[model samples]
Target: EAAVTQSPRNKVTVTGGNVTLSCRQTNSHNYMYWYRQDTGHGLRLIHYSYGAGNLQIGDVPDGYKATRTTQEDFFLLLELASPSQTSLYFCASSPPDGSNERLFFGHGTKLSVL
Candidate 1:
């Protein structure tokens, strides 16, 4: 089975602070993505990486950065957080190895910036 897990499922921060969300996939997926889900809006891509040490900026990359240190792990960083950045973030993986070819998502991390 394909499984993606995230840490710090909930977070609260000040208007200008730093927050980190971590995700790991047991399936060794090659493509991983970070996205924030807002009310009544579709999932907005924050960042993505094809493999370790490769970062791909996405639509909502502002105020956010990402790192892929290992084939199984992806992390999202919010350097200077804001209330606007407060939302539910999800991590997903698309291994594409015919084992877990579909996008599998983590439960999500709920972030709130005051």
Candidate 2:
């Protein structure tokens, strides 16, 4: 089975604070994605990448930044975070074929901005 690990299970920060969330997958998946889950809005994509050093902007990319440093590592950066940016963040990895059914997700990181 594919496994994804995320650091800092929970976080609390003030407005304009800087935050970095990390995710790593051991299954060697080619596609990695960052998403934020909120009430009413459902899961909204923030960013994604198919390979190292590549990033694709997603639906909610205004307040987020993502980077794929290596095949197994993807990072999400929230610079100048605001209260509206506070939500449950998730990291997921999928096979090269980009099948949603084959995606593996992390436990998630809850972030709160005060």
Candidate 3:
């Protein structure tokens, strides 16, 4: 099994806020992703990376930024967080073989923008 961990299980901030969500994977996966889950949008990709020092914009990249510092560490940054961006955020990692079935996910970070 893949070991993925997230920090600050929950967070709260006012409008136009700033927040950073963190994730770490110990399985040495090459693909890391950040996603948000909302009532209507389901799961929307925010950002992703192929490996360390690489980044790729996702479906919802307007208000988000991400960085992959190392193969195990990936971070999501919300510079001007808005209420619309409040949602359950998840981090996941997959092997380099391109098999989506082996994706492993972190518990999640719940952010609330007031």
Q: Regarding TM-score, does 2 or 3 come out ahead?
A: 2
> Which candidate has the top score in lDDT?
2
Error of 2 at 61 (Å): 0.4
- List the candidates ranked by lDDT, beginning with the highest: 2, 1, 3
Model 2 lDDT tens row, 85-105: 989999999988735547799
The sequence of per-residue lDDT tens digits that candidate 3 reaches over residues 14-112 is 999889999999988899999999997899999999899999999989989899999999999999999998899999999886465477999999999
lDDT of 1 by residue, 1-114 (tens): 889999999999998899989999997789999999999988999999989999999998999999999999999999999999989999999965566668989999999999
Off by over 4 Å in 1: 97-101
- Candidate of highest TM-score: 2
lDDT of 1: 0.93
Task: Give the TM-scores of the predictions, in the order they appear.
Answer: 0.94, 0.95, 0.94
Q: Choose 1 or 3, whichever is better by TM-score.
A: 3
Candidate 2 yields a Cα-based lDDT of 0.94
Whole-model lDDT values for every prediction? 0.93, 0.94, 0.92
